[model samples]
Target: MNLKVSKEAAEWYKNEMDLKQGDYIQYYVQLYGGIPTVHPNYSLGVSIGKAENIAIKDVVEGITFYFNSDDAWFLEEFDMEVVFEKEELEFIFHKK
Candidate 1:
C-alpha cells in the first residue's frame, strides 16, 4: 500500500492539530462514524500518536503521517491520499 499527503492537507493538519516538526500523525481503521469508501461500514480515523510498526507512511512539512501494521488489512488493496478540499481533509483511495 502507498500513502500520500497533499501540501495543503499537511498544512491544515499542522495548524488544526497544533503539531510541530517530528510529530506523528496516525491513520487507522475506525469501526464506525465516518464516511466509508474502501470498506463497507468502516472508515478511517486520524490521531496524533507514535507508531509501533509502520505499514505505510508519508512525510510532509516535517510531520510524519503513518498507518501502523495492525491497520494494514484496511489499506492493503489501495493507495490512499489525503487532500485539503472544501475546507476539510478528504481521503481518496485508489484500488491497487
Candidate 2:
C-alpha cells in the first residue's frame, strides 16, 4: 500500500524522532468494538503502507493511500510499529 504523509505529520515526526522523508513509520488505528449503538475500544492490527511526499496541511482531511486500485484508506495518526522488511516495498511520501 502507498501511504502519504502530510506536512504537519512529517514535521511532528521529525521533531519527535530522528527520521527523514524516505523513512518508514509505524502507526495504529482504533477500531470500535461493541454493540451497534455503543462505542467500542480500539483493537489495533498491523498494516503496512508507504509515506507519500505531501505535506499534512495539503491533506486537509488526512493521509490517503491505496491498498489496491479500487480500495484506499485515510490515516488519523501515524503509528510507530510499521516498518519495511527486507522484502517489503518502501512507502514513499508525496507532496501535495
Regions of candidate 2 where Cα sits further than 4 Å from its true position: 1-4, 29-39, 43-96
Backbone clashes (count) for model 1: 0
lDDT of 2 at 10: 50
Residue range 23-83, candidate 2, lDDT tens digits: 5444333466321211135433323346543332222123332232212233223321222
* Clashes by residue pair, model 1: none
State the local distance difference test value for candidate 1.
0.88
Best by lDDT: 1
Taking all chains together, each candidate's TM-score versus the true structure is 0.93, 0.30
RMSD values for the candidates in order, in angstroms, are: 1.2, 12.7
